[model samples]
Target: MGNFIMGKGSRPFVMENQMLMRHGLITGATGTGKTVTLKVLAENLSEQGIQVFLADVKGDLSSLAEPLENNPDIQARLETLGVKDFVPRSYPVTLWDVYGEKGIPVRTSIAEMGPLLLSRLLGLNDTQSGIMDIAFRVADEQGWLLLDLDDLKAMLGYLSENAATFRSQYGNIAPASVGAILRSILSLEEQDGDLLIGEPALHVADLLQKPGEEGMIHILQSQKLYLKPALYSTLLLWMLSELYEELPEVGNIDKPKIVFVFDEAHLLFDDMSKALTDKIEQIIRLIRSKGVGIFFVTQSPMDIPESVLGQLGNKIQHALRAYTPKELKDVRAIAQTFRESEGLDVAEAITSLQTGQAVVSPLDPDGTPMPADIAMIYPPKSKIGTLAEERYGELMRQSPFLFKYEQRVNRESAYEMLSTRAEQLAREQEAEALRVQLEKEAKEKAKKEAKNSPRSNREGITERFTKNIAGTVGREVGRTLIRGILGSFKR
Candidate 1:
C-alpha cells in the first residue's frame, strides 16, 4: 500500500493507508480548501483501490470523473510543494441523486430506515415518535412492508383509526400524535422527501467497488437535497447505519473498504435529540471495526458535537476568520482540539491560513495522532469543479446502477395490503347490514299481510261458533249416559 502525500510541512506530510479507517475531520471557513482536501483524500483512496462515497453538496465534487487539465497556478503550487510524482488523472465515479434528475436515483425503504432515524427525519416530537414506532411494529406484526411514503402514510392512517385496538398491546397511540406524523409526512412530500424512499432500494454492497477493478467514487448530487437539511442529513446517516449493520467485522484492516465524506455535517447535529446524538457517537466510535471510515467536513469545529468530534483521529483545519470576539474564541477552541506542534501557535495559524493551506494532524504509522502541521493541500488529480453537461450525461448513461435503480418497484406493501384489508372488511360489513335489513323487511311484510287477510279472519270466527254449538249438544247426551253408567256401577 502506497502512502499518499497530503502536503509538505517541515517534511512531506503523508496520510498512511492503514489509518484511513480511524475516521477524520476536515473543517474550514467557506473557500478555505476543505473541498480540495476532500478531493485529495478521495482520489488517493481510490488510487489505492478503496471505494469512496461523498456528497457533492455544491456540485463541485462531480468532476472527479473528469481529468484535470494543465493549469499554471496548480503547476506553480506543485513546484512549491516539491511534488515529484503528480499526474493529472480521473477516477471511476458513479453519480447518484435522490431527485433522479441529476443522476441515478438512490432510494431506501422506510423499513430499512426504521423508526428512530425516520422520526429524526420527520422532526417528530416524543409522542409522535412513539406513535411512529408503534406504526412500524404494527406493520411488521401484520406482515406488512413499509417500503415508501405511501406505505408509511397508510400505516399511520390505520393506526389512527385503530388506536383503541392497538392501545391494549402497543400502548396509547394518541390521535393527535398520528395527526402530527401525517402532517409531517405531507410536509416532507412537499419538500420532495418522498423521492428518497422506495423500492429498488440501495444495496450497501453496491457502494463497494468490484474486486479486480479500480475503486469507484460514488458521489451523491446534493445541491437540491441540501436545501432540506433534515432529509439531507438523515439520508446520509441512514447510509452510514446501513454500512455499519451490513459490513462484517474486519477489525483494523490494512485499509478501509469504504471511506465516506459527510459535507455540511453541522446540519446533522443541529436540533438533534440527545438519544440520537449518542447513537451517532457510538457509530463513529465503533464503525472502524467494520472497515468503514467517516470524514466530517464542515465550516467550523464548533459545528460538531464534542462527543462526535473526539472520535476523529485525523484532523485538518483550514482558515477561520476571527474578527468578532465570539469568532476568536471559537478559533481558539478549534485550535485546542489539535496536539500542539513546536513553534506553531495553532490559533494564530488557523486565522491567517492561506486558501490552499490548512493545519493537519494525520494519524502516525503506529495508529497515533501526530502533532499539528501547517501544510499546503495538494490539488486534486481530477478536475476541480462540475463536469461538463454532456460528459455528465454520458457517464450517467453508462452507470451500472442506472438500470438497476432507475425504475421504482411498488409491490404489495403496507399501503396495498392495508387498503385491501379495509376493503374486505367494508364488504363484509355491507353484507351483514344488507342481511339484517332484508330480515327486518321480511318480518314487516308478513305482519302487514296477516293484518290485511279478511278471508282468514272470517274462517276463524265460523269455526269457533260451529265448535261451540256441537260442544253444548254433545254435553247433554254425555250427561245422560254418564248418569246411567254411574247407577249401573253402584248396583
Candidate 2:
C-alpha cells in the first residue's frame, strides 16, 4: 500500500494505508477544524484509490465535488508546511439523500432495518421494544415483507388481533404497549420517515465504487436530516451494519476496501441500549478484518465509549478549550490517552492549537502508535464550501443510479396483504349476518303457519312432550360423560 500523507509536523507525517483498516478518530471543539480534518482524510484516502463514504451533516462537505479556490493564505500555509506539487482539484463524488431533495433518494426496507435499530429510532422503552421484536418475529413467520411504515402498522394490528395466539409463542404483548409503539411509529412518519423506508432500497455495492485512481466519494446530504438527530444517526448505523454484513472477510489487506467517516458520531451512542451498544462495539472491533475502516468525527474523545475508543488506532485531535476546572479535567483526560512524546506537553499543546492544526497519532508500519506530534492539517483540495444548487442538481442527474432509484416503487407488501385480508374478513362477516337474518325470518314464518293450521292443538302438544323428554335424556347423558371425563384425571 502507498503511504498516506496526513499533514505536516516537524517532518511530513504519513499514515500507512494498511493501518487505516484498523479504524481511527478525529475529535475537537465546535470550530476547531474537525470537519476540515475529516475532509483531509477523505481526500487522501480517495487519492489512494480507496472508496469513501461519509455524511455531509452540515451540507458543506458537498464541496468535495469542486476544486478549492487558490488564495494567498493557502499558498503561505503550503509554504510553511513545506509542501510541493499541490494542486487545486476535485475528486470523484456522488451525492445521496433520504428525503430525495438534495440528491438521489436512498431508502431501505423496514424489514432490513430490523427491530433493534428501529426501536432506537423510536426511543422505545424495554417493554415497548420487546413488543416490536415480537412484531418482526410474527412478520417473519408469516413471510410478510415489511417494506414501508404501513407494513409495520399492519403487522402491529394483526398482532393485536391475535395476541392470545402469539402470547405463548413470542411473549405477552400488552395492547397498551402495542398502541404506544404504533403512536411512536406515527410520530416517526411525521418526521419524514416515509422518504426513508421504501422500495428500490440502497444497495451496499453502490457505496463501493472506484472508477479511477481516486476512489469514489459518496456524500450523504444530511442538512435537513440533521434536524431529526436520531433518524440521521440510526441511518448511518444501519449502513455500517450493512457494510459489516455484506463485505466478506479479507483478513488484513494492504488497505481498506472502504473507509467510512461518521460525522457527529456521538449521536450513535447517545442513550443507546446495552444490547445495541454491545453490538456496535463488536462491529467496530471486527469490521477491520473485513478491510473496512471507520473514523468517528466528534467533539471530544469522551463522547465515544471507552470500548470503541480503544479500537481507533489513528487519532487526530484539534483544539479544546480549558477555561474551567471541569473543562481542564476533560482536556487532561483526553491528553493522557496519547503516547508520551518528549518536548511535547500534550495537554498544553491541545488547548494552544489553532485552526487546521491537530495532535496527530497515526500508526506506523509495524502497527504501533507513533509518538504524538502537534501537526498542521493540510487544507482540502476540494472547495471549502458547498456547490451551487444548479451544479449539485446537474451532478445528481449524471449519476448512473439516478435512473435506478429515482422513481418510487410500492410493490405488494405487508400493508397491502393485511388490507386485503381485512376486506375479505369484512365481506365474510356481512354474508354471515345476512344468512342468519334469512334463517330467522323463515323460522318465524313456519311457526306462524303451524299455529294457523287446524292440527296445531293435536300435533303441537304431542311434539312438545316428545322433544322435552328427548332433551332431558340428552342433557343427562352429556352431564354424565363430562363428570366421568373430569373425574378420570387428578389435578
Candidate 3:
C-alpha cells in the first residue's frame, strides 16, 4: 500500500478534459507505478468515451481487455472520495503484438512505410539514411512498390547493379552509400525483421474501432519488440504517421480517435539523427488535427525531446530518487513545470511520493498549465497483467475482424518482381554457360576425332581448300609490297 493511495476519495483532481487531449506524458522512475497510473487515466478516459492506444512494453497491461473485478479496496476508495455507484466496466479492446503472437496480424506496405521511418528502424547514419531515402524515391519513380524487406533489398540491389543507368535518370548513387545502407538493412534482417515486414500493417481504423456503446482500447505487446529500440521507436512513429496520413481532420472532437501511450519513451528520441528528430517533431506538431494524442512514458521529464516535451500539456510526476545532485536537479525541474501553489513545495512533494500517489498537473481549458496538486490516482477496475496465452489466441480467432488483414496477399510489389527477375537472370546466365559448355565440348570432340583419324581433317581441309583457292592472291600482295619497297630503294 506504499504507493496505492490515489483513489476516488483521496483528492479532487481533474484527470483530463477530453477536449485538450492533444498530447501528454507520464514519467517516473521504475516502481513509481506509471503502469497503474496509465491504467487509471485510460480507464477513466475510455469511460468518458475516448479511444485509447496503449503500448504495454512490459506486457503486463493486457488485463485492460478483460472486465474490471469487484474489490473492497476499490469500493473503499470510491466511498472515501465521496463518489457513489461505481460500476466495473470493460472497454472494447484489440490485442496487438508486432510478432503476431497476440492479435490479428498488423502490417504496412513498404511503400507506405517508406524510407524515412525505415531508416530509423535500420539505424542508418546520415549518409546511409540518405541513400535509403533515395531508394524509396527511386522506387516511387519506377512504379515499383516495396511490400517487404526483400523488396527493399532487391531495389537496393537493382540500384547498385545499375548505378550508371540510375545515375542518368535520378543522379549518382555512390557505391559507399549503398554499402552502408545495405549493411543497416542486414542488421535489421538479423533481428528477424520478417515480423515487421508483411501485409496487414496495423490499421488506424483497428485502433479506432469501438463496437457498440463501449469505448475501444488497443493494447500493444511491446516486450520483445522493445529489445530492438530502433525498430520499436520506428514502429510507433510509423503508426503515428499512418494515423496522420489516414485520418481526416476532425478539429477538436469530444474525444480523440485514440490515445497513444509510448512507454519507455526516451528510447524513441534518444540517439536519433536530426532529420528523424525533425520529422518526429513535425508529426507531433501536426497530428493533433488527426484526432489522436501521444503520451510519452519514461523515467524523467528530461527523457522527452524538448520539441515534443514542450507540447505535452499534461504532466503526472510520481516519486523520484533524488539522492544525487543531478536527480535532485531533475526534481527541481519537474516541480517548476507546474503552476505552484505558495508553500506547496512541489519539489519536496516529488521526492516524497508513494507508489500510487503522483503530483498531478493536468491542463485546464484555454491551454493554461494548472497548479500542481497532490492527487490520488484511482485504481483500474480491470484485472491487471497478462491473460492466459490460450485465451489471447482464442480471442483473435473468434474476433469480429472478418474483412480485416487475414489474407496473405501478393501484389505487384517489389519482392515478387525482383525475385522473379533474379531467378530469370540466373537462369539466363546458366543457359549461356550451358551453351558455351556444349560448344567447347563439340570442339574438343572434333579435335580428338581429327587426331585419331586423318580422314576427319582431310574432308574438312579439302572443303576449306576449295573455298580459299582465290585466297592465294591475298598472300601475293604481301610479297609484292616488299618487292616494290626494295625496288624503290635501289632506284
Quick one: best TM-score, which candidate? 2
* TM-scores, one per candidate: 0.91, 0.92, 0.83
Write candidate 1's Cα lDDT for 1-491 as tens digits: 45778787876778988788888999999988989899998888888888999999999899988889889999999999887789899888889999887789999999999999999999998888888888888888889999999999999989888878887898988878888888999999999988898988999999985535667899999999999999899999999999989989987678889999999999999889988899999988889999998999999989899888888888889999999999999888888988988999999999999999999999988878788999998888899777877776788898878889999898989989988998797777666655655665575566557645786466676775775576567556655655565454444
Q: Can you write out model 2's per-residue Cα lDDT over 1-491, one digit (the tens) per residue?
A: 67878798976678899999888989999999988888888889888899999999888998988999978888999898888988999888889999888899999889889899999999999999998898888788888889999999999999998999988888787999989998998899999988888888899888887777779999999999988998899999999999999988998689998999999899889999999999999999999998899999998999999999999999999999889999999999999999989999999999999998999999998989989899998878888977899887888898998999998899999999999988887777666655655665575567657666787656767886775586567556655654554444322
Q: Write the residue-wise lDDT of candidate 3 on 31-113 in tens digits.
A: 98898888877777676666787787887787777766777876776665676655665566777777777776566767777
Candidate number of the best lDDT: 2
What is the Å distance of residue 204 in model 2 from its true position?
Answer: 1.1
Give each model's whole-structure lDDT.
0.87, 0.88, 0.74
RMSD of each: 13.2, 6.6, 9.7
Ten contiguous residues with the weakest lDDT in model 1? 482-491
TM-score of 3: 0.83
Q: Report the Cα lDDT for candidate 2.
A: 0.88
RMSD after Cα superposition, model 2: 6.6
Poorly placed runs, candidate 1 (over 4 Å): 211-213, 452-491
